[model samples]
Target: MREPADLLITDCSLMTPEFDILDNQYVAIRDTLIIAIGKAEEIKDKYEPKEVLEGRGKLLMPGLVDAHTHTCQQFLRGRTLGEYPMIWSRILVPFESSLSEEDTYLGAQVSCLEMLKSGTTSFAESGGVHMHKVAEATIESGLRGAITCSTMDTGPFIPESMLASSPGEAASRIEELYRAYNGAGEGRLRIWFALRQVMTSTPALITLMADKAREYNAGLHVHLAEHRDEVSYCLQNYQKRPAEVFDQFGALGPNMLAAHNVVLSDGEIALMKERGVKVVHCPRSNFGSHGFPKTPTLMQQGLSIGMGSDGAAGSSLSLFDEMRVFRSGLHAFWGLPIFDPVVIPAHELIRMATSGGAQALQIEDQIGTIEIGKKADLILIDINQPHISPTHRMIPTIVESVNGSDVRDSIINGEVVMKDRQVLTMDEEKILYESGRALPRVAVRAGI
Candidate 1:
């Protein structure tokens, strides 16, 4: 008993988990939500729409969701490559200390443009040093995101301004952010809590962050077990694995989303599954840092696994590239013909980058799928190109073959954010110019 749809998409291949292809379909959308989906003729007869999009020779799928990213790090993309984690940290913390508010905003604009052009509709951003700028940029870019004010308390690596003076101060700042932005921009933006990293944060601070997040009904994002050195450091100092310590602090839950859980034990995987805790597997970041693990093992254990790019510094912020790496790398690791790298499959890869990531952010019901009552977050891929021609299998081809450049349009919350590969929200040229100007200053400050 809802009103008729405002828009309809017709004659396209719609990707779904149960089946890869649906032909000549029409998806009805109204007020930022999908109202109905069916055969073109059937839906056209059922619901009158104000606008109809011809999806002929195009693939219509839910928009990609980046489970983990540092939006403000796009300016540092190529600069941080080839350095170990410790060296990476040394360069990053000092560089971040010198970033002006204008620099932060410009960096976010560049990152948002990159994400949208690459077909990402939603992202979870661990906003560096300045959270307000990151939130403002996300709002301006027409991208949905879970933004966190990164908290660090340790004396090592970072300046005092970047670290919270005390645990109480950190909690207070998080409360202020939650109160101001938790449901801002008509729920397009959400505020979450970040504990920075285990090595730098105290046990008391971790427990307090968990408590605050629960009180606010918000999600917690953190990095865990990304490197052997991280594990060794935790073991040497805390006499516990990072995951176990987090578990002791009452931090494992569906609301908690851990990034790069690469070095977890079988027991830790079991614990994550039992608690319904989700993980963002940045295969590119893992390969760059500590190499890939048996993620198929984590998947087999029924833990929700989503894909991430980590950041420009960790990997190029393209989910398409991540999917390609995932398919080939998992195949290489298993090396069994019947194992079928296709078992995880391309359609599922798209799903993980979209719906699975939304679930990790606890926004699945709102923005992940293109179902009735779900947000109209979707991407249109131009399959008419020579490389993507004769699309016999649309979903698989999209995952395996489609690059970010093939994204013809990106729609978020019933609005077209990018059309014909042109970004609508921000001035891309100005962003690039300002970012170029700022990078040299940042490099000099870090002595890179």
Candidate 2:
């Protein structure tokens, strides 16, 4: 007369929030939450599971959370390689502006499939038009996301179609999207307000969007101090650094998720620290375009930092790759300088991908860890492979050696979206075919 579990995974190595690996562990999922987790032998017979996944040779851990990405930029993958700086205006804007609703949907489908198969259970859309399309793709793909609409009022080279008439219009549009999509898909989706960036947004729009997000209890996503151009623009326009501009507008808060942060002044970092602003580090994109960010310094200051792929346009939609790049870059930049090779150790880096990412998105209470009452958003990695073999130290191996291809299963919100490397919720073949067919039309429209 034991409890009936919706899904059960037994005989797996479970990863704790502390980054410790527990062998012979079993996790029981009932509906959308983890109901029980304990030693496999002691707990295997306690539940009558509707479905059971043999987790032997697999590691069950909290799925990676991508704190920032661009679903609409999925098709632009490999298009910006070796491009100059300010590709946002030179390349990305035209492409995004040219996309139709259907185009956006297709891009989202491709992006979702890439992320899910690569072990990302949750992500935050950096902001784009036709976000409903992205939301639809996310819901259909069974992934969790905080999505936002692209909001811009004034900036050089911005397309007329992408600009809002005024700050009020931008705030109204974002509020509408929040009302329509926030907490959608059984709370798997949350709508957020976007500032796009300091250069693209006016002070009025920034303040208004911040106020609206607070009113709706939603998050505000923005790119802060991401590059030299943005910092220069802010200094010229407002006589302040980019992060300082947000503080001046009273727009910095816990609900604000700022990406890149490649060029923050010490004062701005301190201000952001005081305001509890979350940070998303896009290592591949940032390092190539802007120099290395103050990741180690930010971590030392106790900022909540998360990893992001920034979308497939610049980097692969895999947090595993981001983790590797971030760690190596940090070791070279900070570690070599200070003669300390252990700068931002592997365990801490993995924490940034998991709990830190959930914290950045303000969803830690629901998803980030393997514990009872938390939503069952998890990934199973087949670690019995050649690359990850001889797993002497589990955490280091996960951070250093493991790649997205090792992800054997992905479960989000208690549903097994990908099992045995095959995506269950998404039509992979149809999406791949459609993406190939649509790219030519998109390139023509984008004038790429």
Candidate 2, 188-262: lDDT as tens digits: 999888899988998889899888889888899998888898888987899989988898897999999999999
Name the candidate that leads on TM-score: 2
For candidate 1, lDDT tens digit of each residue in 132-247? Answer: 88888889999999989777888577777788888889988877877877777767999998787887788788888888889889899998888888788878987888888888
RMSD of each: 2.2, 0.9
Predicted structure 2, TM vs. truth: 0.99
Clashes of 2: 0
Give the Cα error of residue 436 in candidate 1, in Å: 3.0
> Of the candidates shown, which would achieve the greatest lDDT relative to the real structure?
2
